[model samples]
Target chain A: MEKKKEMVKTKRAQKKDNKWTQNDKVFLYILIPILILFFVFNTLQLLKGFYYGLTNYKGYGDYSFVGLRNFIDLFSDARVGKSYVFTFKYAIVLTIIVNIISLILALGLNKEIKGKSVLRGIYFVPNILGGLVVGYIFSFIFTYILPAIGQMAGITFLQNSILASTKSAWIAIVIVGAWQGIAMNTIIYISGLQTVPEDVYEAGMIDGATGWEKFCKLTFPLILPFITINLVLCMKNALMVFDQIMSLTKGGPSQSTESISYLIYNNGMSGGQFGFQSANAFVFFVVIVIVSFLQMKFLGGKEEQL
Target chain B: MSENMEKVTKEAVEGAVTNENEGEAFAKKRRAKHKKQSGPVQGKTVNRVINILLALGCLTVLFPLYMTTIIAFKQPSEMTNDISGALGFPAEWKFENFTEAMRVTDFWHSLGNSILITGVTVALCILIHSLAGYVIGRKMIKLKAFKMSYYYIVSGMFVPFAVLMMPLVKQTAQIGIANRFGVIVLYTVFFMPMNVMLYTGYLKNIPTQLEEAAHVDGATAWQTFWKIIFFNMKPMHATVAILTAMSTWNDVMTPLVIMAGTDENTLPLAQLNFQSQFGTNYNLAFASYLLALLPILIFYIVCQKQILSGVVNGAVK
Candidate 1:
């Protein structure tokens, strides 16, 4: 160890004397290709997306720069407005539902319960499965199995497929989304709950604090960061929800569930409203950045208080 | 009798004092026993309630999976409109549903495609991202350019893929890689920012002295990296590989848009394409979904402990 430390010191001295070393060459060789790829795929695509937003370009040959025409159309376009609304509504509702259920599960799992590991494993199964497949499975459940059970039980609401009606379709989507979404959040919250030292609870015990008080005053404050992460992640994912929507409803029943992402893909790639959708995509991008920023600012501040 | 009782009480008190001073473990055991004797009746009931509730929650979580499995095995004739039809087991478990699913979806072909895509993307991500991370992580403090580049790449985290979907569709075709290969390249790039962040953050703990020692031994930069740095990054590799593999395996959009006209199909895309054609023949659809799910499911079941912890580690970053 001593020899190695001495050697490191000597090497640093030699490196300071040399203007261009073998390491510099290695750095450039590695960095240049990565940067080139990044520029081509990521940077170029972003610029092209922004530029295309200004053009009258279809997916094909010729186009003229229309200069914010697509942006102008975006505001008045009822479909765009509807998608934005749906996305926000879905994001907000799912975020709250998912976090609550996950926190509850996490709290339960954190206790010295029997078969806790097994229970956790089962809850986490949904996270590993693909969203599209889960959506399809749930689609069948909603379409057939629930109605069958409802008919058998004589329950009026369940007798009909909830997905068939636009009013209740989003509810079905939310059910499936929450089922799958809570797994990761629960895992995260469990991890956060585990971080609370046993001695802190012992301290609470000395103060004669009830379970609920202990959680609100001690556990809640400690895990606020994890909560922040879960909320931000859930909200972000909900906004970009595509796979489940694709499999379940395809943004259907008169496009009531058309998320911003679904709208972009449906119109931009296949609908040949490429240029117009590009403008919408740009706006969606800005919204996400702002939402993330706001979440960080708000939640991060709350975290700092404790 | 009174004198004997006094002696017994004094000895018991002394024993308790000694246990407190020198036998923490013994004291803990005694306290545990005391608590159990006093409170176990109510505690047991509460535990039972929690257990029942959790069991129900587990049932809800597993319900879709159970339905999928049963429906996959059922014969088409058995798939009636009633609850019994959906719930009842098959008289003879039809393994051929899987075979038919494979045939309809070209299961081997798509499975091979999914594996190839995931395998190659994971390999490239580890190889390329680690190198970039090493360079940027080590040199960013000294070089202003590296610092700028770090921020530049990390900023891509905020850019949603939807924004780039249209332009990339056109761009990939124009570049003549509107196929699996192109998708592979794009996946490598798509995952760059996050993976780089993970790797660079990880590299902070790996000391520079190891590299200096290798340099003193006349080893080249590449040699040092291949021999020392790569192996040191095993934990991060597990995190990155699992994350990349899961996403690449399950992803539907990239293949949908990029591999549109191509004959190649990832598992999700194949299942999707066959979905409408199967229509009411859900036995076949369920079978295909199971088959698509089988590989990842097996992978998860095996490495679940590692995967779960890795997810927590990755999410924090």
Candidate 2:
């Protein structure tokens, strides 16, 4: 009887061990294919960008590498230079204004109020809509309402075509950008505000700190982490501003609003300057990385914190 | 007991030591308590004022939308003129503009194309993202050890659509799916970073033992994941579904680039087509814009909670 029991136990253990090995093999086999595909696709895309950047391949036949000529052309191109400046300015201004407005709005809405959630939802609805839709909607405002307001108020400040003037076009674009973007910033700020312990605020209140003092001392410091994140996102998203610019102005009124992304789109898809466009794209990618990295480093402080 | 008596005696001494200090502390406490009592009442009044102010502010936000919607129904003369009419509720509700807009553009055909493209993209996105997330989440994959692997996939997020447009268009044409399902799949891949982040974040909170128990009960890895893990991801699935659906549904740029060779335009592209076709008819153009926005508006109104919930959940992290 003892010998029979030992045999059965050995058989059961062997079956379980076999299953474990099989499961390991399955995992190994499946993972290999996924990893290969992921690596191959990503590398191909990156390599294609680099390879195309080096060659003057204008969407045609065999091409040879023209070392740094495209970069030279990029520098000399007046539109590219102006666009670089314009995009940078727009991004900086938008990031600052949007972050400030959102932080204020978040604080305002965070107060004790009924239907606050519903109001927040209403505010956020525009964000869910496409950038193009928002742009299209604003186009009507700039073209119609602004002119009407100018007529009613007897001021030619905005005029019929706000985007026609270089000075005002960038401002209009940034305002529209900020308006569309406030929801994301507000949400992030609210999330950050939630992390601040309630006792901290209570302590501040007991200390007889004024609202402004409380904001500058307690709220801003506590929300610095979120501030960094919101700034980074705002910068990146603004730098890549495309659809809104497209529907709103199409980088128009003598190309004052021509963002880098729009310029790339025009050169590559519209102009058929694939190689030059690829180089521009590479430069844009580098700039974005450096700017984002510098911002993160400055704000993140310690490496471990990031 | 001695400690209690000593604390009482200390309080008594404090009360008697400085009448001024006691009076101030007592008065301040009373004031604070009173303020706390009336805080909600005052808060409501302030909120009411704020709400009205915010509503006025929101009118500024909604003015353009209102103008567009109203003028779409109004005559061209009415639209071009500063007529004294409220932005909402035109004096005469005209249904003819809808039909006129439909006729001016190939609205039905374009709508069909948009729906097909969006549907295919969403389906492909859900499939690939879920499959990839499941394997990475549950399986002890070797390359998963290389932490950079996930980053490599996610790094595609920041590669702007413009950068990829030239190469993607060329590749899609070369592969002969530029205007077909290939475009859809590539679109799915283009925006997969957020999905991956969401799923990974979500999966981290789930226990691996559930799948392990299933595997122990004689199920394949895929089966175990499909039955146990994926089923449990209802909220995440709902959020991703709505988000990706909204994204693909409203996308204009991708279809514009890929579908340029053909009249296989989406609703947004169709609106552009309508604008060019009826350049003089601003009313028709605005009507076409309204038509394109109608389905999305309806969807948003119906699924407000889902849409808002998705935004809050995906964004807060």
Q: Model 1 clash pairs?
A: none
**Residue B247, candidate 1: C-alpha displacement in angstroms:** 0.7
Best by DockQ: 1
* Residues A1-306 of candidate 1: C-alpha lDDT, one tens digit per residue: 788778778767887797556787688788888999998999899888999999988888899999989999999999999999999999999999999999999988877787788778878988988888888999999999999989989999999999999899999999999998999999999999888889988898789876689999999999999999999989988988999999999999999999999999998887889899999998888899899999998898888343
Where does candidate 2 stray beyond 4 Å?
A1-25, A31-42, A195-197, A302-306, B1-44, B83-89, B139-146
Q: How well does model 2 score by local distance difference test?
A: 0.72
Ten-residue segment with the worst summed lDDT in candidate 1 chain A? A19-28
- Best candidate (score: lDDT): 1
Which tens-of-lDDT digit does each residue in B2-25 have in candidate 1?
233234334434544554343454
Model number with the top TM-score: 1
Candidate 2 per-residue C-alpha lDDT over B144-199 given as tens digits, one digit per residue, 9 for 90 to 100: 44345467666666676666667767777777776847657667777677776677
Off by over 4 Å in 1: A1-22, A304-306, B1-44
